[model samples]
Target: MTRVVFLLVPQVHLLDLAGPAQVFSTAADLGLDYRTEYVADREDVPTAQGLPLRAGTEWPDLESGDLVLVPGWRSPKTAGGPRLTDAQVAQVQAHHARGGTVGSVCSGAFALGQAGLLDGRRCTTHHSLQDELARRFPAATVERDRLFTTDGRVVTSAGIASGIDLALHLVAVRHGPAAAAQIAREMVVYARRGGDAAQDSAMLRHRSHLSDAVHRVQDLIDVRFAEPLRLADLASAAGVSERTLTRRFTESTGLTPLRYQSVLRLERAEHLIAQGSPVESAARAVGFGDARMLRRLRSARFQS
Candidate 1:
C-alpha cells in the first residue's frame, strides 16, 4: 500500500488539507492501494477555522512510492499561523531524498521551500502569495495563476480548491485518466481544469457540462479517441439526433464532436512526438492517415 501522510501545521486551512485528503480517501474507497494519515509537530493543532485537530506527533516510516503533503495554513500576515520547525523541514527533505513524492498546497509551499525541495525547481502557490514566495525563495521558480505545477517529485498547487485538481492529477499519474474522471464524477466535480496552458487531459478539459447525455458521449470519446468515430453512432449512444448532438456538444464543450476528437488526437500526437516518435508514425498511431493533416492541425491549433 502507498502511504499518503499529511503534515498538519498550526492554523491550517481546512480546505487546503481536506480537499486533497478527500481525493486520496475517495481513491481508496474506489479500491486504490492508498493509506492516508496525518502528522504534526504537536498532538493537538489549532485550525484557522477555530477548531482543534488531533494528529500523530511521530512520523511514520515512509519508502519509495509514498507521498508527503503539506497543506497551507493561515497567512503569515495573520496571527497564530505557525511555521515549520527546522526538524519538521528536515523530515520533508528526508522523505524526498528517499525517493518519495512531496507536495504542497497554497502557502504550504513555504514548508517545501524551507526543506530545500523548491530550490531551482518550478512550483506555485496561492495567487495572493506568489510575489512574496518569490521574494522569500529567489531560487525557486514561482509560476503565477497556475492550478498546480509538477517539477520532478515535488508538486505544488494554488489556493484552496485547486488542491483537488492537484490530487486528481496525482491519481491520473498513478492510475489513469479514466480513474481520475470517475473520482471527479463521484465527487460531483464538474471538470478538471488545466494549469499553465493545456496540461490537463482531454477528458478533464472537456468535462464541465451538466448534461448526462453529453457526459456519456465524452466518456466514449475519451477512451476511444484514437479510433474512428461516426456522428450517427455518437448521436445514437446519446439518444439524440445528430444535429441536436452537434449543437448541444458545441454549446456545452465549445467544440464539435469531431473537433473534440481531433484535439485529443493532436494531444496524443504531441506526446508521442515528445517521446521521440516520428511525425508520420505518431499521426498514423492516432488514426490519421498521414502527417499532412496532423501538421496542418497542429499549426492551426497553436496559431489559433
Candidate 2:
C-alpha cells in the first residue's frame, strides 16, 4: 500500500491539491491500495480562492508515505502566514531520507526548496517566480519553461493547471504507461509528455547564447529538418572545427548538435501525426524517410 500525505498550508491552491488527489483516488478505484489524507500545521487551511479546507491529520501525527504532494502556496507578495517552521522542515527532510518520493506544484516548490531538498537538483516553478527562485537558491538549476521536472524521487511542476500534468506523470512512473494512458483518457487530458520533450524545449531556449555561427547553423537545421545536415558544412559556416562546435553546443544545451536536431525533427513529425498526417508522409517530412523507423523510435523512446 502507498500512503500519500497532502501537506496543506495557508492559502493553498484548491485545484492544485485536488488534481493529484483525483488521480490517486482513481488509482484506488482501479484496486490499488493507496491512501491520501490532508495534513496541516494546524487543523484549518485556507485556499487562495478564500475557501477553507478542513485538515484531517495533525502534522506531528502524520506518518511518512510513499509519496507526498504539496500544493502551491499563495505568493509571498500576496499572503501572510508562517514560513515552513523548523518542525515542518525537519519532518519533510526526514521523509526524503527514508526514500520517500516527494514533490510540489507551483509555489510549493518554495517549501521543498526551503527544506533543502532542491539543492543541486533541477527544478521548475511558476514562470513569474523563476528569477526570484534562482536568486534565492543558487544550488538549484532553475528551469524556466518546463511544466514539470523530475530528478529521481523529487519532482516539481510549473504554474497552476500544470499540476494535473505532473500528477499524470507520477501515475505513469508509479503504475505503468498503459495505466497512465488509460487514466488520461478517462480524465480527458492529453497523454503525459515525455521528459525528453521538456529537455528539448529547455535546451533550445538556452541556445541563443551560443556563437553567431552556431545560431546560424541551428536556424538552417530548424527550417530544413527534412534535409540532410552536413557536419562539415555546418562547422565551416560557423568558422569552427567540428569538434569545437560540438563541444560548445553540448556544453550550452546539454545535448549534442545532432541529437538536438533529431529531437526538433521528431517534434515536428509528432505535430504532423497529431494533425492526422499519414505516418509515412510525416516521417518523410521529418527526414526519417521510413514510417517503420519512426515507429521503432517512438516505441523505444515513448512506447507509443
Candidate 3:
C-alpha cells in the first residue's frame, strides 16, 4: 500500500488541500491500496477561508514508496502564513534524503525551499507567487506556466485546481493511465488536462465527451492499447453495432476507434523514442509489427 500524507500548513487554501485528498481517497475507494493521512504541526489549523480543521500532530511511518505533499497556503504578505518549523523542515528533508517523493502546490513550494529540496531543480508554484519564490530561493530554477514539474523526486504544481491534475499525474505514474482515468471518471472530472506541451497524449486528450458507450470503449482501449484488437472486439465490448460505434465514437472524439488506438500507440512510441529507445524497439513495444508502420504514422502525425 502507498501512503499519501498531506502536511497541512496554517492558512491553507481549502481546494489545494481537498482536491488532492479527494483524488487519493477516491483511488483508495476504488481498491487502489492508497492510504491518505493528514499531519499538521498543531492539533487545530485555521484556513485562509476562516474554517477550522483538526489534524494529527504525530506523523506516520513512511517509506520510499510513500509520498508527502505540502498543500499551498495564503501568501505571507497578506495574512503571513507561518513558515515550517525547523524540525518540520528537517523531517521533510529527511524524507527526501531517504529517497521518497516530496511535492507541493502553490506557496507550499516555499516550505520545500526551506527544506532545501528545490536547489538546482526545476520547480513551479502559483503564478502569483512565482517572482517571490524565485527571489527567495535563488538556487532553485523556478519555472513559469507549468501545471506541474517533476525533477528527480521533488515535484511542484502551479496552484489551486491544478492540484487535481498533479495528483492524477502521480496516480498515472504509480499505476497506469487507465487507473487515473477511472479515478477521474469517479470524481466526475474530465479525464485530464495536459501537464505540458510535449506531455500531451491520447490518454489526456479525447476524453471531453459524455457518451457512456464511447467512454466504456475508451476505458477498455486505454488498458489494452498495446494489444492487437479488432473492430468486432471493441464493438462487442461497447455492446453496440460496429457501424453505430464508429459513428458515435467519431462524433465524440473525432477519431475512429482504431484510429484512437493508433494515436495511443503513436504517442507512447514517441515517448519511448524520446527516452532513447531505438525506433524499431519503440515501435514494437507500442504494438506495431514493425518500424515501417510506426515511421509512416510518425510522418503523418507531424505533417497533420
RMSD of each: 8.0, 10.3, 9.3
Q: Give the TM-score of candidate 1.
A: 0.66
Candidate 1 Cα errors over 4 Å, as ranges: 78-81, 197-304
Clash pairs detected, candidate 1: none
C-alpha positional error of residue 292 in candidate 2 after TM-score superposition, expressed in Å: 16
Q: State every prediction's TM-score relative to the real structure.
A: 0.66, 0.65, 0.65
- Model 1 residue 108 CA deviation (Å) reads 0.3
* Cα lDDT, model 2, residue 242: 97
Q: List candidate 3 stretches off by more than 4 Å.
A: 197-304
lDDT of 3 at 30: 93
Residue 191: error of model 3 in Å? 4.0
User: Residue 18 lDDT in model 3?
Assistant: 96
**Clashes in model 3: which pairs?**
none
lDDT of 2 by residue, 1-304 (tens): 7888888888898888988888788878877677887888888887889989899655434344478788887785455333677877887888888887889988888888889989999998887878878877899998877889998679998857788778778887778777877777777775456532342352266575746766877777777767888888878877899999898777766777787777777777786887579989999988987898778767776854
